[model samples]
Target: ILHPISVLEEEDDEAVIEKYSGSCLAGVSPKLPPLPPKILVEKVAPAPVLLSMEDEEVVRAVVSGSIPSYSLE
Candidate 1:
């Protein structure tokens, strides 16, 4: 389910940019899935280690009290 670019601002836009490379959606800025960073940590365990520290940090918020609420359908 592709979303309009406006949805990108609802979440971290960098995920699309970070995950885009080496993915099938190369050259495209796809919408970031509106999952919170906790879910990201769940998936990140088995994810590729090639991601940079910044990218890894993007998967988790810098502070626990700061986890942004993800907009769910």
Candidate 2:
């Protein structure tokens, strides 16, 4: 006994279906705007020294308020 071989026919619409499917289905994220230009900073002078309270003066100021208060403002 001999068996007949069966062949499947390829659809003409397969190419069209593949062309419209899968990877292309996802939406692309919008491109972000370019960042602002970098600012050029000049060399700044060292900060000025404020009050220099001695340990004794600090103690006297806190205990008796005899020393003038140092303003941080």
Candidate 3:
């Protein structure tokens, strides 16, 4: 969203620079709308738990290509 005037000025293209150089000669630029408000978030921690022997067996089976690994619950 950069003004073409700024870019042309940087490139030193003075030929077309005179056209956009005047603001008071043309008219005032329109004001842009304000941005949305910032959102606040709270940190969360997962519950602590231990995996059963069956769970371990399922993991091993999946690793060994005996079963496909997917969500259990």
Candidate 4:
């Protein structure tokens, strides 16, 4: 046995949008103006420093002490 085949019709698609979604749409934006003065004068400070210290070098000094040297005094 045999069966029949189907086919589709074709034409110019220049007006597909107008037929489905109506006419075209568009938008626009405004321009920007100049800004006013914000500052009058400027002053900047200096940076700081940090140090790690040892107590014997800055506060006191050790010459020699092992076996009762202070008893001689």
lDDT of all predictions: 0.56, 0.61, 0.69, 0.44
The best candidate by TM-score is 3
Tens-digit lDDT string for candidate 4 (1-73): 2222223245335444334443323344566687987887677676755434663333233334433435435
The parts of candidate 2 lying over 4 Å away from their true place are: 1-27, 50-56, 59-73
Question: By the TM-score metric, which is better: model 1 or model 4?
Answer: 4
Error of 2 at 28 (Å): 2.2
lDDT (tens digit, per residue) of candidate 3 on 12-72 = 5675566556544345577899999989888688888788999889888889988866654
Residue 53 in candidate 4, Cα distance off native in Å: 6.7
Model 2: weakest 10-residue lDDT segment is 1-10
**Residue 18 CA error for candidate 3 (Å)?**
21
Per-residue lDDT over 5-73 for candidate 2, one digit per residue giving the tens place of the 0 to 100 score: 333366456664565455452476888999999999998999976665686567667678665566422
Q: Residue pairs in steric clash, candidate 3?
A: none
Q: TM-score for each prediction?
A: 0.21, 0.29, 0.36, 0.25
